[model samples]
Structure formats: structure tokens, C-alpha cells
Target: MKDTAKHQGLRNQLVKLLAEKGIYDTNVLNAMNAVPRHLFLESGFQDFAYQDTAFPIGAGQTISQPYTVAFQSQLLQVKADDKVLEIGTGSGYQTAVLCKMGAKVFTIERQNELYRKTSVLLPKLGYRPRVVSFGDGYKGLPNDAPFDSIIVTAGAPFVPQPLLAQLKIGGRLVIPVGDEKQVMTLLIRTSETHFEQHEFGDFKFVPMLEDKNR
Candidate 1:
């Protein structure tokens, strides 16, 4: 679907709603406004794209709720040129937001269908991340270790150690940790072996698959 004036208007309203809900980060707000969320979903779901809710995007995964996306993006506090590692590419909506925030994003997706579709869709919309690999998100990207920040778009029963090991000192890792319900958790690597932890209430997300087969 083409991003028309009406779509932009809806996005603006969404941004306002996000701001009202305490997403104070202006960078995150602007990035959310810039990305055409409707284009990321199937045409039939375009009508619900701007709403702050999650909708299925096939393969049993749903594009995350807009507030969740904005909340995670705000938690990262990404700066221009910061190397950010994203744990689940999903529909590439979060990846696009990171790109818009001037981050050099390297993302991995466990679902092959989403991996292939997002790989093509993102660049076509001019939101090109550094790498969009079809692999396990739990393992993180060791070859590109020491990222400035990392964000996990799926819910995990526990925090993956490899992801923590891959962060640079002072880097942030935003993830939702739980089984049925998730508590939004953040880990900031302060030293080589130490990390500061914080939690921000609960959210629901598709379980993060372990292997690339999905």
C-alpha cells in the first residue's frame, strides 16, 4: 500500500498516543512517525496498522504492538552510527525504526519466511540494515560482537548468555523475559563481566524460537 497523506496523519496520531503513554524519547517518536507501518503488513491489515495493537503477520508470528516497539526503541537510546544488534527481525518494522534512528543494525530472524520477506521489503523501502541473517536469535551474532546496543523483539523464558556476552561495555540489551507473560527487562553491560539490570512491567510477545528451522 502506498503511504498517503492519510496514512501519515494516522502515524502522527499514533505518535501522539505513544507520547501520551510516556514514550518520551523524541528520536523514537520521530522514527515511529517516519516508518510506514502499513507497508509492513499485508494490504488487508493496513486499516489496523496505525493502531497500538499486535496483529498476526503469518508464520504464527505477529508484528509487535506499536507501543512495545516504541518502548523498546526508547530503552536502547540509540545514537547515530551506533552499532545495534536486533535479536528478532520479525516484520522488519523495528529494524526500520532503528535504521531511522541512525543505527547500523545487524538483525537475525529464526523464521525463514519472515527472513526472506523482510530481507527484500526493508531495502525496497530504503531502510537498509547492515545485515539481516536467517539464523538463531539466541546465539546472537558473535562475529559482530561488542555492539553498542541490542534489542530482542520476541519473548524468551530467560536471557540468553551469548547475547549478554556480545555487548560492549555500556551497551544496553532490551528483552522481554518470561514464560507465558513477559516482564520487559534491560541489561546494560557496565564492565566485561558485570551488567546493570532493570525491569519495566509486563508485555506479551510470541515465543522466541531457538533454531533457524522455524
Candidate 2:
């Protein structure tokens, strides 16, 4: 929970690394630097938290690499106070990033263990989202639909229709789509019945499961 000067220095280096990788969003970078990522990991893995690579957290999940988190956050184009839906809340790292940027986030995690742990850890660190759920995310939080943007941290074989339907007109949905490997895809709602889609490069993610546990 303590963000020592040493931790801040490491985060500064991480920010430069992210900038070199072509992430130019100052808001996103500032938020990244502000959040002490080391606090989000277990003590044993804390030292590597600032690295540009993913590390396993329990329950078959991995906290996304800093680059990935920044990349996705930038692509989502989050405006302050935008209501965003995050499909996976592993480690609550990305959730913290969005919250630091002042987005009202609604996140869902299918792993009960992860959901339970993060549900508690986030607030303790002062990164509270609007809602966190222990349920399948494929259905897309209908009760809180029409999000300004939606970000899926886990890999999905295809875009879930429910997620598309949940987006407000002009909202964006950022997701990785495919199996084994995924193409980073972005969807922007253009009208009541249309969405613009684009794909950029590739990434690997734990599959976004259909059921609570499978």
C-alpha cells in the first residue's frame, strides 16, 4: 500500500517505456504512473510489477502487462466521468487505471476467487469501481448497459452481441477477438444499428469463459 520513492522511480521508467512503445496519451500515462502497480500484486511478485510483461495472479489469471493496460486504456478513449464496463477484473489493475482517470467502471469476473479477492482489495487501495460481480461476463451487465465504453480484458472467440447491444450510440468497445491468439479489435457504435470495427496486431489472453466456471 506504500508507494515509496523507489516505487515511484520504477513507475517513471515504466512510463518512458510505454511512451517509446507508441502510447502517447498523457492522461493514460499519468494515470499509469499514479497507480502503484506493485501494490496490486502479491509481495513475492511485487518487484516485477513494473515490468512490461504479464505475470500470473492466482485462479488461472494474469495481471495484464503495463503496456497492454496502457494500450487498451488509450484505445478505449476514456473521457473523465465516462461510464465504462470492464469484462474482466483480474488483479484490479486495469480497473485502477480507469478509476484513476475518473471513469465510472462496472467490472465482472467469472472466477469467484478473483472476484472475492479483488472486491476487497480495490477499495482498500482506494480504487473502487461502480460495481464488481462474480458472474459470467458474456451476458454483459444489462442492468447497467449503455456504457460510454466497454473493455474486455479476457480474450473472446467473437464479439458478444450482448456487449455490442450494451454500448450507447457513439460508444466504443475494445476487445481481443480470436482463439489461441487474438487480434486486438475496436468497435465504435455509429448509429442505432451500426458499428465500426477495426483490428490492430495481436495479443494472448485467458479466454473469456461463457459460464461461471468451466
Candidate 3:
């Protein structure tokens, strides 16, 4: 009961922070609150779980800040039962949020260590993404094509063509594109041959590297 109360307190604090920052989407807020962020971090890092900064999660990857996760998830405009694809599954925090939002997620992680750890943790968190592979996130899951929404956590120089090909018509793809310094971008697939792009704002992220499977 004490752990539950602690998690609830953290959730309330996060909701308050997000609201003050103008993240007014109720769905996003609910999803963020539902997932226990502290469980996704190292036990010692529990105190910082409610804070709005990224933290190390081994293999040079960091669990993205809470606001950033909410921002990207909101930009995707995910809907209930929507088939979603997540490019990076670091810590599985974002994946858990997406799952709690009622999306059927297929997440891929390139790092073997992160993938292994998250695979075990996700089931314990009560939300298991359909597929968590130690493969190239850049290539995406070809077998699971035509996703309603796709989210890329790492920064890429340009939107990968393969991911574009995997989106269903009218689907949205939210990603960060650039080198060390990046900008969050949203791409809407208007038709079989047309896509509309929107730039969100300047941000920084780890560079998206091609996994060995590529």
C-alpha cells in the first residue's frame, strides 16, 4: 500500500506539471498517470521519476523526459485500438504509456541489453507490446506493416523511407530528425503517394544508428 501511494503521488505531481506546461490532452494525461514511471527506472532513481529529465538506462540510452514522451505521444494522436509502432524501446517506459493509452504497440529495440531487460519488465508492468525485437529500428517491422501510428524515439538524419512505406494512409509518424541536435517532426500520410510534414521544434536526442540486422 505504501508503494501504491507513492506511485499515485508521483502521478498526481506529473499531471500537475504537464497541465501547467499546457499538455491539456486528457488522454495523454491519463496515460501518463496510469503508468508507474518509478518502476521503469532503477530503484535508486525512483525519487527522480516524477522529475522532467531523462535518466541513464544502460547502453548509452536514457529514458526520455516525461514531457517529451507526452509531447511525442500527443503528436501521434493515437486512438483506441490503433496499431502503433515504436522505434526504440529503451526502458519500455514509453511503450507502457502507449499500451495504457489502448494502442496495440509493436516496439523494436536495437540494443540487445535494453531489449532483454524491457522484455522482462514489460510483462511485469502488465502491458506487453506485440513485438520487441533486437533488430534495426530504422528498417521497422516489415511483417507488421500499415501501422496507424509510428513513433521513433531516436534522432535520425532524415525520415527513413521504409517507415514511410509502412504507414497506412492517413496514419501519422512522429519522429525526431537530425544529427546530435534534432527537431521533432510529424509526418502524415495523406495518400499512397503523398505525405505532409510538420516540424514541431528544436530538440536534442541520441542519434539513430542502424542495428546489425540492417
Off by over 4 Å in 2: none
lDDT of 3 by residue, 1-214 (tens): 0248877887899889998987877889999998888888887788888999889888888999999999999998888999999999999999999998989999999888899999999997788788887789989999999899999999899999999999999999999999878899999999998999999898878778985532
Model 2 Cα lDDT, one tens digit per residue, 105-160: 99999998889999999999988899998788889899998899999999999999
**Clashing residue pairs in candidate 1, if any?**
none
Regions more than 4 Å wrong, model 1: none
Error of 3 at 54 (Å): 0.4
Ranking by TM-score: 1, 2, 3
The 10 consecutive residues of candidate 3 with the worst lDDT sum are 1-10
**Candidate 3 wrong stretches, greater than 4 Å:** 212-214
For model 3, what is the C-alpha lDDT against the true structure?
0.90
Model 2 poorest 10 in a row by lDDT: 205-214
Count backbone overlaps in model 2.
0
Best by lDDT: 1
- Clash totals, every prediction: 0, 0, 0
